[model samples]
Target: MSFWRAVLAIIFPPLSVLGKGCGSFFIVFLLWICGWVPGVIAALVILNNPER
Candidate 1:
């Protein structure tokens, strides 16, 4: 993942994954609702995946 994206993921997880797809956005959004840490973690994991 790019440095900016990782920063974005840290600040706003769901927004960072906006381009990934609807499902990913929703997943991150839900995770964000449950807890900020989970959302950030999920966004980073998703962003780090080479096979988007």
Candidate 2:
């Protein structure tokens, strides 16, 4: 992930993964609603995926 994306993921997980896909965005958004850490983790995983 890029530096800004990493930072964005930490600050706002769902937004960071917005370009990933609708499914990913929703997943991160839901995880964000549940808790902060999960959302960040999900965003990072999705963003880091080479096959996205």
Candidate 3:
């Protein structure tokens, strides 16, 4: 992942730019940075939830 993308994941804990090209790894990292609940929520939204 890109440096800024990783930084973004750390700060936002699941909120990265859409199609930022970071992928699931970024989501997992974000979860690790934050916690389980936030991580799972982020992953679900990123992986399954549609754009609104």
Q: Tell me each candidate's TM-score.
A: 0.97, 0.97, 0.38
**Tens-digit per-residue lDDT, 1-52, candidate 3:** 4566555644654554445356665766666577856764564455444442
Let me know the TM-score candidate 3 reaches against the reference structure: 0.38
Where does candidate 2 stray beyond 4 Å?
none
Local distance difference test scores for all models: 0.98, 0.96, 0.56
Clashes of 3: 0
lDDT at 31 for candidate 2?
Answer: 97
CA lDDT of 15 in candidate 1? 96
Of 1 and 3, the candidate ahead on lDDT is 1
Candidate 3 C-alpha error for residue 31, in Å: 2.8
- lDDT tens readout by residue for model 1, 1-52: 8999999999999999999999999999999999999999999999999999
Candidate 3 lDDT (Cα, whole model)? 0.56
- Model 2 vs. true fold: TM: 0.97
Q: Give the TM-score of candidate 1.
A: 0.97
The better-scoring model by TM-score among 1 and 3 is 1
